[model samples]
Target: MKAIITVLGRDKPGIIFHVSEILYKVNANIVDLDQTVLEDKFFSMILVADIDEINCDYNDLKDKMDQLGKKINLQIKVQQEDIFNAMYSV
Candidate 1:
Protein backbone atom coordinates (compact mmCIF):
# COMPACT_ATOMS: atom_id res chain seq x y z
CA MET A 1 0.00 0.00 0.00
CA LYS A 2 1.00 3.60 -0.48
CA ALA A 3 2.19 5.50 2.56
CA ILE A 4 3.67 8.73 3.74
CA ILE A 5 6.65 9.07 6.02
CA THR A 6 7.07 12.33 7.84
CA VAL A 7 10.36 13.43 9.35
CA LEU A 8 11.18 16.53 11.34
CA GLY A 9 14.32 17.58 13.13
CA ARG A 10 17.37 19.82 13.01
CA ASP A 11 18.71 20.75 9.63
CA LYS A 12 22.15 19.46 8.86
CA PRO A 13 24.30 18.47 5.95
CA GLY A 14 23.56 14.96 4.65
CA ILE A 15 20.19 14.86 6.39
CA ILE A 16 18.51 14.18 3.08
CA PHE A 17 21.11 11.68 1.99
CA HIS A 18 21.00 9.84 5.30
CA VAL A 19 17.23 9.60 5.37
CA SER A 20 16.77 8.91 1.69
CA GLU A 21 19.44 6.27 1.85
CA ILE A 22 17.46 4.42 4.47
CA LEU A 23 14.30 4.70 2.45
CA TYR A 24 16.03 3.52 -0.69
CA LYS A 25 17.62 0.63 1.16
CA VAL A 26 14.20 -0.50 2.35
CA ASN A 27 13.01 -0.54 -1.28
CA ALA A 28 10.68 2.39 -0.92
CA ASN A 29 9.72 4.21 -4.11
CA ILE A 30 9.78 7.91 -3.47
CA VAL A 31 6.87 9.40 -5.30
CA ASP A 32 7.01 12.88 -3.87
CA LEU A 33 8.97 14.83 -1.30
CA ASP A 34 8.92 18.29 0.22
CA GLN A 35 11.48 19.66 2.61
CA THR A 36 12.18 22.94 4.31
CA VAL A 37 14.26 24.37 7.10
CA LEU A 38 12.61 26.73 9.53
CA GLU A 39 15.07 29.13 11.12
CA ASP A 40 18.18 27.15 11.92
CA LYS A 41 17.04 24.73 14.54
CA PHE A 42 14.12 22.90 13.01
CA PHE A 43 13.71 21.19 9.69
CA SER A 44 10.96 19.07 8.26
CA MET A 45 10.46 16.64 5.40
CA ILE A 46 7.37 14.94 4.13
CA LEU A 47 7.87 12.01 1.81
CA VAL A 48 5.27 10.01 0.00
CA ALA A 49 6.61 6.64 -0.92
CA ASP A 50 5.21 3.38 -2.19
CA ILE A 51 6.02 0.51 0.12
CA ASP A 52 4.07 -2.32 -1.41
CA GLU A 53 7.28 -4.29 -1.64
CA ILE A 54 7.73 -4.60 2.10
CA ASN A 55 7.69 -8.28 2.90
CA CYS A 56 6.51 -8.22 6.50
CA ASP A 57 3.38 -6.88 8.09
CA TYR A 58 2.79 -3.18 8.59
CA ASN A 59 3.48 -3.45 12.30
CA ASP A 60 6.94 -4.74 11.61
CA LEU A 61 7.70 -1.80 9.39
CA LYS A 62 6.49 0.56 12.07
CA ASP A 63 8.76 -0.97 14.66
CA LYS A 64 11.76 -0.80 12.36
CA MET A 65 11.00 2.83 11.66
CA ASP A 66 10.73 3.61 15.35
CA GLN A 67 14.22 2.32 15.78
CA LEU A 68 15.36 4.26 12.75
CA GLY A 69 13.93 7.45 14.17
CA LYS A 70 15.64 7.00 17.49
CA LYS A 71 18.88 6.31 15.70
CA ILE A 72 18.61 9.53 13.73
CA ASN A 73 17.30 11.77 16.52
CA LEU A 74 14.31 12.80 14.48
CA GLN A 75 10.60 12.47 15.07
CA ILE A 76 9.28 10.15 12.39
CA LYS A 77 6.00 8.55 11.54
CA VAL A 78 4.58 6.29 8.85
CA GLN A 79 0.94 6.10 7.93
CA GLN A 80 -1.17 4.47 5.29
CA GLU A 81 -2.06 7.18 2.85
CA ASP A 82 -5.75 6.41 2.96
CA ILE A 83 -5.91 6.61 6.73
CA PHE A 84 -3.97 9.83 6.73
CA ASN A 85 -6.21 11.32 4.11
CA ALA A 86 -9.33 10.21 5.91
CA MET A 87 -8.22 11.97 9.06
CA TYR A 88 -8.56 15.24 7.18
CA SER A 89 -11.78 14.38 5.44
CA VAL A 90 -14.63 16.84 5.87
Candidate 2:
Protein backbone atom coordinates (compact mmCIF):
# COMPACT_ATOMS: atom_id res chain seq x y z
CA MET A 1 0.00 0.00 0.00
CA LYS A 2 1.10 3.54 -0.66
CA ALA A 3 0.50 6.34 1.81
CA ILE A 4 0.97 10.06 2.10
CA ILE A 5 2.80 11.52 5.08
CA THR A 6 2.91 15.17 5.97
CA VAL A 7 4.85 17.09 8.57
CA LEU A 8 4.55 20.67 9.73
CA GLY A 9 6.41 22.60 12.39
CA ARG A 10 8.85 25.33 13.09
CA ASP A 11 12.00 25.09 11.02
CA LYS A 12 14.79 23.23 12.71
CA PRO A 13 17.44 20.62 12.23
CA GLY A 14 16.97 16.83 12.23
CA ILE A 15 13.30 16.92 11.13
CA ILE A 16 13.94 15.03 7.94
CA PHE A 17 16.34 12.64 9.61
CA HIS A 18 13.90 11.71 12.32
CA VAL A 19 10.91 11.40 9.99
CA SER A 20 12.89 9.27 7.55
CA GLU A 21 14.21 7.16 10.37
CA ILE A 22 10.69 6.26 11.47
CA LEU A 23 9.71 5.32 7.93
CA TYR A 24 12.91 3.32 7.50
CA LYS A 25 12.28 1.39 10.68
CA VAL A 26 8.93 0.34 9.26
CA ASN A 27 10.49 -0.65 5.91
CA ALA A 28 8.57 2.07 4.09
CA ASN A 29 10.06 2.91 0.73
CA ILE A 30 9.80 6.64 0.11
CA VAL A 31 8.84 7.12 -3.51
CA ASP A 32 8.49 10.89 -3.65
CA LEU A 33 9.17 13.78 -1.32
CA ASP A 34 9.02 17.56 -1.25
CA GLN A 35 9.75 19.93 1.60
CA THR A 36 10.44 23.58 2.21
CA VAL A 37 10.76 26.21 4.87
CA LEU A 38 8.27 29.03 4.54
CA GLU A 39 9.14 32.52 5.76
CA ASP A 40 12.35 30.93 7.00
CA LYS A 41 10.51 29.57 10.02
CA PHE A 42 7.68 27.17 9.20
CA PHE A 43 8.78 23.81 7.94
CA SER A 44 6.60 21.58 5.82
CA MET A 45 7.16 18.24 4.12
CA ILE A 46 5.08 15.84 2.14
CA LEU A 47 6.04 12.40 0.94
CA VAL A 48 4.62 9.29 -0.62
CA ALA A 49 5.81 5.95 0.70
CA ASP A 50 5.17 2.35 -0.22
CA ILE A 51 4.19 0.38 2.88
CA ASP A 52 3.05 -2.93 1.51
CA GLU A 53 6.04 -4.83 2.79
CA ILE A 54 5.84 -3.51 6.29
CA ASN A 55 5.26 -6.02 9.06
CA CYS A 56 2.96 -3.87 11.15
CA ASP A 57 -0.41 -2.43 10.20
CA TYR A 58 -1.14 1.18 9.30
CA ASN A 59 -2.36 2.06 12.77
CA ASP A 60 0.91 1.00 14.30
CA LEU A 61 2.86 3.18 11.93
CA LYS A 62 0.50 6.07 12.52
CA ASP A 63 0.88 5.76 16.27
CA LYS A 64 4.65 5.70 16.00
CA MET A 65 4.66 8.74 13.75
CA ASP A 66 2.27 10.52 16.07
CA GLN A 67 4.55 9.88 19.00
CA LEU A 68 7.52 11.08 17.09
CA GLY A 69 5.68 14.22 16.09
CA LYS A 70 4.74 15.00 19.66
CA LYS A 71 8.26 14.33 20.82
CA ILE A 72 9.67 16.70 18.23
CA ASN A 73 6.93 19.31 18.51
CA LEU A 74 5.64 18.83 15.00
CA GLN A 75 2.30 18.06 13.42
CA ILE A 76 2.33 14.79 11.52
CA LYS A 77 -0.35 13.06 9.52
CA VAL A 78 -0.44 9.76 7.63
CA GLN A 79 -3.11 8.63 5.25
CA GLN A 80 -3.58 6.03 2.59
CA GLU A 81 -3.16 7.54 -0.85
CA ASP A 82 -6.65 6.78 -2.01
CA ILE A 83 -8.26 8.19 1.08
CA PHE A 84 -6.13 11.26 0.82
CA ASN A 85 -7.10 11.77 -2.77
CA ALA A 86 -10.76 11.26 -2.02
CA MET A 87 -10.72 13.77 0.76
CA TYR A 88 -9.00 16.40 -1.33
CA SER A 89 -10.70 15.80 -4.62
CA VAL A 90 -13.39 18.07 -6.00
Candidate 3:
Protein backbone atom coordinates (compact mmCIF):
# COMPACT_ATOMS: atom_id res chain seq x y z
CA MET A 1 0.00 0.00 0.00
CA LYS A 2 0.98 3.60 -0.45
CA ALA A 3 0.63 6.45 2.01
CA ILE A 4 0.98 10.21 2.10
CA ILE A 5 2.68 11.93 4.98
CA THR A 6 2.33 15.69 5.35
CA VAL A 7 4.30 17.81 7.75
CA LEU A 8 4.01 21.46 8.72
CA GLY A 9 5.57 23.73 11.33
CA ARG A 10 8.28 26.22 12.05
CA ASP A 11 11.34 25.67 9.93
CA LYS A 12 13.93 23.43 11.53
CA PRO A 13 17.09 21.70 10.52
CA GLY A 14 16.37 18.06 11.26
CA ILE A 15 12.71 17.70 10.43
CA ILE A 16 13.26 15.56 7.38
CA PHE A 17 15.88 13.43 9.08
CA HIS A 18 13.68 12.81 12.08
CA VAL A 19 10.51 12.06 10.12
CA SER A 20 12.34 9.81 7.67
CA GLU A 21 13.96 7.97 10.56
CA ILE A 22 10.60 6.92 11.93
CA LEU A 23 9.49 5.67 8.55
CA TYR A 24 12.77 3.89 8.06
CA LYS A 25 12.40 2.04 11.34
CA VAL A 26 9.06 0.74 10.14
CA ASN A 27 10.46 -0.23 6.74
CA ALA A 28 8.37 2.33 4.87
CA ASN A 29 10.22 3.23 1.72
CA ILE A 30 9.98 6.82 0.56
CA VAL A 31 8.97 6.99 -3.04
CA ASP A 32 8.76 10.75 -3.42
CA LEU A 33 9.11 13.87 -1.28
CA ASP A 34 8.61 17.60 -1.62
CA GLN A 35 9.38 20.23 0.99
CA THR A 36 9.90 23.93 1.26
CA VAL A 37 10.24 26.73 3.74
CA LEU A 38 7.52 29.34 3.39
CA GLU A 39 8.67 32.97 3.62
CA ASP A 40 11.81 31.53 5.17
CA LYS A 41 9.92 30.78 8.35
CA PHE A 42 7.48 27.87 8.19
CA PHE A 43 8.24 24.39 6.94
CA SER A 44 5.98 22.23 4.85
CA MET A 45 6.41 18.82 3.30
CA ILE A 46 4.45 16.16 1.47
CA LEU A 47 5.95 12.72 1.20
CA VAL A 48 4.77 9.65 -0.62
CA ALA A 49 5.88 6.32 0.74
CA ASP A 50 5.45 2.68 -0.13
CA ILE A 51 4.13 0.89 2.93
CA ASP A 52 3.49 -2.58 1.69
CA GLU A 53 6.53 -3.89 3.56
CA ILE A 54 6.05 -1.91 6.75
CA ASN A 55 6.85 -3.91 9.84
CA CYS A 56 3.71 -2.77 11.66
CA ASP A 57 0.15 -1.79 10.92
CA TYR A 58 -1.00 1.68 9.78
CA ASN A 59 -1.96 2.76 13.25
CA ASP A 60 1.50 2.02 14.51
CA LEU A 61 2.96 4.23 11.83
CA LYS A 62 0.49 6.97 12.70
CA ASP A 63 1.39 6.70 16.39
CA LYS A 64 5.07 6.88 15.64
CA MET A 65 4.56 9.89 13.40
CA ASP A 66 2.48 11.54 16.09
CA GLN A 67 5.13 10.95 18.71
CA LEU A 68 7.82 12.36 16.49
CA GLY A 69 5.70 15.40 15.76
CA LYS A 70 5.17 16.00 19.45
CA LYS A 71 8.86 15.65 20.16
CA ILE A 72 9.81 18.07 17.40
CA ASN A 73 6.91 20.47 17.46
CA LEU A 74 5.38 19.81 14.10
CA GLN A 75 2.02 18.84 12.66
CA ILE A 76 2.29 15.50 10.93
CA LYS A 77 -0.50 13.62 9.22
CA VAL A 78 -0.52 10.15 7.72
CA GLN A 79 -3.18 8.86 5.39
CA GLN A 80 -3.54 5.91 3.10
CA GLU A 81 -3.17 7.09 -0.48
CA ASP A 82 -6.69 6.09 -1.39
CA ILE A 83 -8.20 7.97 1.51
CA PHE A 84 -6.16 11.05 0.80
CA ASN A 85 -7.23 11.09 -2.80
CA ALA A 86 -10.84 10.55 -1.85
CA MET A 87 -10.85 13.40 0.62
CA TYR A 88 -9.52 15.81 -1.97
CA SER A 89 -11.63 14.62 -4.84
CA VAL A 90 -14.72 16.63 -5.57
Candidate 4:
Protein backbone atom coordinates (compact mmCIF):
# COMPACT_ATOMS: atom_id res chain seq x y z
CA MET A 1 0.00 0.00 0.00
CA LYS A 2 1.06 3.62 -0.60
CA ALA A 3 0.40 6.65 1.54
CA ILE A 4 1.69 9.86 3.01
CA ILE A 5 3.29 10.07 6.41
CA THR A 6 3.34 13.26 8.42
CA VAL A 7 5.65 13.97 11.31
CA LEU A 8 5.15 16.92 13.55
CA GLY A 9 6.88 17.79 16.77
CA ARG A 10 9.46 19.92 18.49
CA ASP A 11 12.35 20.97 16.29
CA LYS A 12 15.54 19.05 16.83
CA PRO A 13 18.51 17.70 14.97
CA GLY A 14 18.44 14.33 13.18
CA ILE A 15 14.68 14.11 13.09
CA ILE A 16 14.64 13.69 9.34
CA PHE A 17 17.49 11.22 9.38
CA HIS A 18 15.92 9.18 12.12
CA VAL A 19 12.63 8.98 10.30
CA SER A 20 14.03 8.48 6.82
CA GLU A 21 16.37 5.78 7.97
CA ILE A 22 13.49 3.68 9.25
CA LEU A 23 11.72 4.07 5.92
CA TYR A 24 14.85 3.00 4.14
CA LYS A 25 15.37 0.03 6.43
CA VAL A 26 11.87 -1.10 5.63
CA ASN A 27 12.58 -0.94 1.88
CA ALA A 28 10.10 1.84 1.29
CA ASN A 29 10.93 3.99 -1.70
CA ILE A 30 10.47 7.69 -1.14
CA VAL A 31 9.14 9.21 -4.31
CA ASP A 32 8.77 12.70 -2.88
CA LEU A 33 9.42 14.43 0.40
CA ASP A 34 9.04 17.99 1.57
CA GLN A 35 9.99 19.26 4.98
CA THR A 36 10.23 22.59 6.70
CA VAL A 37 11.07 24.21 9.98
CA LEU A 38 9.11 27.02 11.57
CA GLU A 39 10.06 28.48 14.91
CA ASP A 40 10.57 25.58 17.32
CA LYS A 41 8.65 23.02 15.34
CA PHE A 42 9.47 20.75 12.46
CA PHE A 43 7.00 19.42 9.94
CA SER A 44 7.35 16.96 7.09
CA MET A 45 5.20 15.21 4.55
CA ILE A 46 6.46 12.31 2.51
CA LEU A 47 4.87 10.69 -0.48
CA VAL A 48 5.68 7.84 -2.91
CA ALA A 49 6.86 5.23 -0.55
CA ASP A 50 6.42 1.63 -1.74
CA ILE A 51 5.65 -0.46 1.30
CA ASP A 52 3.98 -3.44 -0.31
CA GLU A 53 6.93 -5.72 0.24
CA ILE A 54 7.48 -4.48 3.75
CA ASN A 55 7.15 -7.11 6.46
CA CYS A 56 4.11 -7.03 8.74
CA ASP A 57 2.29 -5.28 5.95
CA TYR A 58 1.55 -1.60 6.68
CA ASN A 59 1.54 -1.98 10.43
CA ASP A 60 5.30 -2.13 10.38
CA LEU A 61 5.31 1.38 9.06
CA LYS A 62 3.11 2.45 11.93
CA ASP A 63 5.34 0.71 14.41
CA LYS A 64 8.40 2.46 13.11
CA MET A 65 6.70 5.79 13.50
CA ASP A 66 5.42 4.78 16.88
CA GLN A 67 8.93 4.04 18.02
CA LEU A 68 9.99 7.48 16.97
CA GLY A 69 7.01 8.94 18.73
CA LYS A 70 8.14 7.40 21.99
CA LYS A 71 11.68 8.59 21.51
CA ILE A 72 10.90 12.21 20.68
CA ASN A 73 7.36 12.76 21.85
CA LEU A 74 6.37 13.51 18.27
CA GLN A 75 3.10 12.84 16.56
CA ILE A 76 3.40 10.59 13.54
CA LYS A 77 0.66 9.16 11.43
CA VAL A 78 0.67 7.07 8.28
CA GLN A 79 -2.48 7.12 6.27
CA GLN A 80 -3.69 5.19 3.28
CA GLU A 81 -3.59 7.21 0.08
CA ASP A 82 -7.33 7.01 -0.43
CA ILE A 83 -8.07 8.10 3.11
CA PHE A 84 -5.75 11.03 2.86
CA ASN A 85 -7.26 12.05 -0.46
CA ALA A 86 -10.75 11.85 0.91
CA MET A 87 -9.83 13.98 3.89
CA TYR A 88 -8.60 16.74 1.61
CA SER A 89 -11.75 16.62 -0.48
CA VAL A 90 -14.03 17.63 2.37
lDDT for each candidate structure = 0.80, 0.93, 0.94, 0.76
TM-score of each: 0.82, 0.92, 0.93, 0.81
Counted clashes in each candidate structure: 0, 0, 0, 0
Candidate 3, residue 59: how far the Cα is off, in Å: 0.7
Report the C-alpha lDDT of model 2 over 1-90, residue by residue, as the tens digit. 798999998988999999899899989999999999999999999999999998788999999999999999999999899986788898
User: What's the TM for model 3?
Assistant: 0.93
RMSD of each: 1.8, 1.4, 1.3, 2.2
Model 2: lDDT to the true structure: 0.93
lDDT string, candidate 1, 31-75, tens digits = 999988898779899988888886667777677778878887888
Per-residue lDDT of candidate 3, residues 1-90 (tens digit): 899999999998999999999989999999999999999999999999999999998999999999999999999999889986788897
Report the poorest 10 consecutive residues by lDDT, candidate 3: 79-88
lDDT of 1: 0.80
Which ranges of candidate 2 are over 4 A from the true structure? 87-90
Q: Rank the candidates by lDDT, best first.
A: 3, 2, 1, 4
Best by lDDT: 3
